[model samples]
Target chain A: MAEFFTNPLVQSVLVPVAGGFILTGAIRFANGRAKGPLVAGAAVALGFLVGYVLIVGLPPLPPVSNQQKLAYVVAGGLIIGFLMDFSRRPPFYRELVYIVGAAAALYWMALPKIAGGTAWTYLSLVALWIAAGLIGYRLEKSRANVVNACAPLLVAALGLGLVALFGRTGSYSQLAFSLATAFGGFMLWNWPIARYPFGATLLLGGAGALVTIAYALALYTEASPYALAMLLLCFFAEPVARRIKLPAGKIGEAFRPVAVGAVALIPALAAVAVAYLTAPGQEAGY
Target chain B: MRTRSIIAGAAALMASTALIGTASAADNYKIDATHTNIIFIVDHLGFSNMIGQFQSFEGNFSFDGKSVEGASVKLTIKTASVDTDHEARDKHLSSPDFFNVQEFPEMSFTSTKFEATGDKTAKMTGDLTMLGVTKPVTLDVTFNKADKFPMDPNVFIAGFSAKGTVNRQDFGMKYAAGAIGDNIGLWIEAEGHKQ
Candidate 1:
C-alpha cells in the first residue's frame, strides 16, 4: 500500500480523482439519489480531505500552521455549507453566514500577514474571494444547468493549480489539483444533464477552496499574483458564456457545460501563461 | 584634607577593579557569522548524502569551561537562505514543501537543558521550532576550546561543534518522504567571540 503511493501518478492524479469519485458516488447513493439542493458539496470536501491525508499526509491536529489551518477550514466549511444548503432563511442570514465564514477562514490562513501589519493584503484577498463566492452563489440561485454552474469554478481551480506549479510551489499546486479533480468527480454526475440538485454546498466548497488556496499561494509562496487574479476573474466568464448563442432546448443544454467551461478555460490558460512568464529562475538540470 | 584625598583615591581604584572583574567573568559570547557554518546532510535516493547550508543566521551562547550546566544557546536561521548549490532547488526548498519561507520565514532553537557527558563532551537539549511546530531535540555537543584569539591575544573566543538528527516528517515536511530521506542530519561548526 505504501509502495503504491510512491508512484508519482498515484500520488498526484489517480488517487485524488479516484478517491473523489468513490466518495461522491457513495454520498449520492446514501442520499437516496435525491435532487435536493444537497448534492456534491460534502463529497468533494471530504474527498479532498482524504486525498490530502493520503498524498500529503494529515496536518497537525492543533493546526498551528496555515497548511493545517487550511485542512480545518475545508472541513469546517463542509458543515457550514450543509447548513446553507438546508436553510430557507432570509438572504441576509445566508449572506452573513458566508461572509463570517469567509472572514474566519481568511483570518486563520493569513494570520501571520495580518499580525505583521499587512492588513491591506488580507483585505484585498478577502474582497476578491468574497466576490468569487458571490459569483458562485449567483450561479447556485440561477435556473441554469448544474454543469454550467460548476464548470467555471472547476476550470478556475485547474488554472490556479497550474499557476502554483510553475510559480515554484509544488505542494500548493498539488492541493489545488486535488480540489480540481474532486470537483471533476462531482461534475461527472451532473454532466449532459442535471442528475442532482445544486445549492449552498457547491457554492461554499467550490468558491471556498479557490479563495483559501489563492490566499495561501499569494501570501505563502512566490506564485505570481497576476496569474492568481486573472484566474479569479475567470469565474466572471460565465456572464460572457451566458451571452453566447446556442441551440433552442435540450440540444443546446447538452452543449452548455462545454461552452461555459471552454470560455472560462481561455482566461485560465492565460493565467497559466502569465505564471510561466513570471516564474522565477530557469530549472537547473541535473 | 590629606586623609580625605587618600580615602577618595582608594575608593576610585576599588571601583575600577570591581568593574574589570565583572567584565572578565561574563560568560556570554556572540556567534561570529564569519567563522560559523550551519549545514545539514540528507540522503538523496540512497545514492549519496546531499549537503546544504544556511547562509544567514545569528546566535549567542553562554559557556563557562566544561561545567556544562545551565548554559544556554539560541539561534535563528533564515529559511530563505537555505542553499543546496542549485538556484532552482533552493527556491523550491523555500516553498511549502520544505520551509514554506513565506509563512514561516525563520527556524529557531533555544536550549532548555545541558548535561556533561565527558570532560569535553555534553548533551544539550533544546526546542527546535520549525514550520510553526516545536519539538525537543538533543544534540551531542563538544567543547573544542575556549581561549584568547591567536590573531589578537587580548580578545577572547570560543569554538564548539554540535551534531544531531531530526525527522522532517515530525515537523509536517512530509512531501517526498520515501524518495528524499526523512531523517535530516545536522552539523554545526560554531565559533563565538566574547561580547
Candidate 2:
C-alpha cells in the first residue's frame, strides 16, 4: 500500500478521480455552477467504467487464459478513456487529456533498449500525428478557422522535428510515441476529421500503443503493473484546472493539453540517450 | 648366394624411395589471408537475428593420413570492421560492452593441441584471449582437402572449418541479458597454402 503511494500508476489513476470531485466541488464553491463539472466527472467515470468493461471485461467474459493478469491493463484503459471523456467540456481540456494520456503511455512503453524499442514506434507515431494534424488543418481551413487547424499541425511538426533530430530517450520516448499515435488516431475520427468520434478511440489507442511499445522494447525494467494507467494525471489536469477556474482561454487551453505531454518527453529522450550510450556497439545480427 | 644379395640390395633401395615420397607428400601450409572468415550471430531484442564476419586471419597446418601431425593458428580480428546494419548498436558493440577495443586492442586465438577423432574430424584445443581473459576452448574441426594448387603447384592448398562457443562473461564482456545471449556462437572457415 505504501509502495502504491509512490507508484506513478496509482497517482495517475487517482489524480483524475480526485480532480473530478475537486472540479465539481470547486465549481460549486466558486460559481455555484457545479452541474457542468459534475456532469463531466460522471461522464468521465462512466466512460472509463464502460470502456474498461468493454476492453478488459468483455474480451475474457468467459474468463480466458490470462484474465487475472489483464485486469490492470483493462482498468487502466478504462480510467484513461474516462479522463479523456471527462475533459471534453472546455474543448482544450479534452485535447490536454488525450495528450497527457498518450504521452504517459509512450514513456512507460519504451524501455532498456530505447532506440531499438521506440525508433520504429516513433516513426509510425510521427506519421500518424502528421496525418491527423493535416486533417485537422484541412478541416479548420474549410471552416476558415485556419488557426485551430494550423495549431495541431504546427505542434505536431515541431514535435516530429524534435524527435527526428535528437530522438527520444529513457521513459520519455515511450510516452512521446504514444501521444503522437493517439492524437493522430483521434483526429482521424474526431470533429474536424470524422463527423462522429467514438468516446474511447483516442483514449484506448493511446493507452494500447503505450503497452505495445513497452512490451516490444522491453522497457518495463522501471515499470510497475500500474505505470501504464498513470496518464490520467495529464488527462484530468485540464478539467481539474478548469474547475478551479484558472483564468485564460484559447491559447491557454491549447497549451494546457500539451503541458504534461512535453514533460513526459524529457525523460523519454534522456532514456534513449542512456540506452544508446550503454549498449554502444551493434549486435552481430541486425 | 650372389642372386640373393642382389635381390636384398634392390629391396633396400625400394624402401628408401617410399620414405622420401611420404616426407615430400605432406607439406606445411600457411593461412592465406585472401581466403578466411570468422563469423558470428546473436539475437537482437528477441526480434531479429544479426550476422557479420571478420575480415582477416592467419592459419597453419600439416597432415598425414587424416592425422594432424602438426597444426597451429593465430588470428587477429580488426575491431573496427564490426557491422550489424544499425549504426547505433554497432557503435555500442565496439564500445566497453563487448570488444572494448581501446583497452584490449586485438582478440587472438592460438591453437596448442590437435587430436584426431576420425578420418576427417578432429578436436583442436586453443587459448582464446579476449578482453584479457584466456580460456581453453575446443573446436570441432573438419580437415577438408589438401593438394597442389592448379595455378601454382609450388603452393599447396589446405582447407578446414571449426566451430566453438564462448561465454561473453567468461571474457569480461557483459551487456543486455535477454537482448544478447551470453553464449556467443562463433564459426571460422580457413584455407592455407605453403608460404
Candidate 3:
C-alpha cells in the first residue's frame, strides 16, 4: 500500500484529479454559472493552474525551454476565451480567430526547434500541432468533451510507459502525467451532463502536451519513428468517431467517447509494440 | 682576492636570473579535448554505481608554480553529450529532469581559488553552473605531470586529475531522490597544451 501510494503513476493520476475537482467545484460555486463559455474558460484556467502546481512547483522548475512553452499554453487558453466571447460573432470572424490561434500555437510549440535552427523539425511539429488542434476543435464542436479530453490522457499514458520501459524519469514525463491527471479531473465534470465545455482547454492543453512528448521522444529517447507516427496518428480518433452512427440518447453519449478512445488505442498499441520490439540497450555511450 | 670577489658576484647574478625564470614559469594552456575526459558516477537504487561521461567539452587553465592563487581553470561541457552507455538513459539525463539540455545546453565550471596542498596536488574551488543554477564546489586536484608531448615536442602538455561530489538537489535535480542517490561524484582527467 505504501509502495502503491509512492508510485509516480499513482501520484500523477490522483493529485490532478483531486485538484481538478476542487477547482471546478469552487468555480461552479463562486460563479453559480455551471454552463456556458465563461464557466468553461474558468474551468480550463483553474484546471491547468492546479495541475501545474501539483505536478511541479515554481521554485525548482524545468528548463527554460519547457518553461517558455507555458506561454504558448496560456496563449492557447486566451484564444479559447476569445472564441467563447465572440461565439455569436460572424462565422468569418470566428474562423479568422481560429486561424490566428492555430498559427500562434504552432509557432510557440515549435519555438525550441526553430531556435535550434532545425527548420524541418519545426515545420513537422507545426503540422502535427495543426492536425491535433483541428481534431480537438472538431470534437468540441460535436459536444464531445470526453473524447477531446481523453486524447491527452492517452498520450500521457504512452509517456508513462516510455518512462517505465527506459527506467528513466524527466520533466517531460512529469508533464505528461500532469496532463493525464488534469484531463482525468476534467472528465468528472464533463460526463453525463457537462458542467462546462472543455473544448478550448483540450485543444490547447492536448496540443501542448503532445508536442512536448514528440520532442522528448525525438531528441532524447530512442523511440522509433513508427512509434512517433502512431502517437501522431492517435489524433485522428475524433474525426473517425464523427463518422460512426450510434443509438440516440444517453447510450450514444457514453458510447461516443468510448468509440473515440478505441480508435486512438489502435495506433497507441501499435506504437507500443514497435517500441518494445526495437527497444535499445540500457547502456549509454559518451 | 679581487679576482675571487668578481667571480662570486657573477655567480650570484646567474643564480638570481635562474630563480626569476622559475618564478615566472606560469604558462597558459588550452584544453586538449581528445585527451581530456569528464566522468561522473551516481548510485542506482543502492544496487550499484552507474558511471557516465560527457563526450564533448573544452577547457583551459593557467598553471603557476610560484603562487597557487595565480592558477585558474575553466571548463564548459555540452549537457546533451552526457552518455551512460544507453541511448534512452542518456536522453533522460539530458531531459528537463536533470540537465534540460534544450534550454540550458551547457554546464560550466570556473575556478575561483586554488590552494596548493602538496607539491603535486591542490584544492580547487569553482562555481559549477547547471540548469541555470550556480553553486560553489571544491575539487581535489592532482597535477600528474608537465612535459612536451613525445610525438610533438613543440606542444607542451600538462595533465591533471580531479575529483568532487555535488548534490544533484542543489542544482534543482530533485527527481526520484530516494531511488537515485543525491550526491553525484565527478571524476575528471584533463590534459592541456601550452598556448
Most TM-score-accurate candidate:
1
Is 1 or 2 the stronger prediction by DockQ? 1
* TM-score per model over all chains: 0.89, 0.38, 0.77
- State residue A161's C-alpha deviation in candidate 3, in Å: 6.2
The local lDDT score (0 to 100) that residue A169 gets in candidate 3 is 40
lDDT string, candidate 2, B1-195, tens digits: 999999999999999998787676656667787787788877666786677666655556655534574656666666655666566554445544456444355678888898888888889998998866688888888888788889988777888899888787666554343346777778888888765
Candidate 1 residue B46 Cα shift, in angstroms, is: 2.7
* CA shift of B70, model 3, Å: 0.7
User: Per candidate, chain B TM-score?
Assistant: 0.86, 0.78, 0.87
Return the candidate ranking by DockQ, descending: 1, 3, 2
- What is the C-alpha lDDT profile of model 3 across B151-188, one tens digit per residue? 98898998999999999978877667567899999999
DockQ metric for all predictions? 0.50, 0.05, 0.27
Docking class of 3: acceptable
Fraction of the true interface contacts (Cα pairs closer than 8 Å across chains) found in each model:
0.73, 0.10, 0.31
Model 1 chain A weakest 10-residue run by lDDT:
A32-41
What is candidate 2's lDDT per residue for A1-286, written digit by digit as tens? 6444333232223432343234334433443343332222222233223322322223333321122123344345556654554454444554454445444444333322244546675664444343333332233232222122222322332233223222212222323332343233223222232222234422243333333333322222222212222221222232233344323855564444344335434434443344433442223332
Task: Return the top candidate by lDDT.
Answer: 1
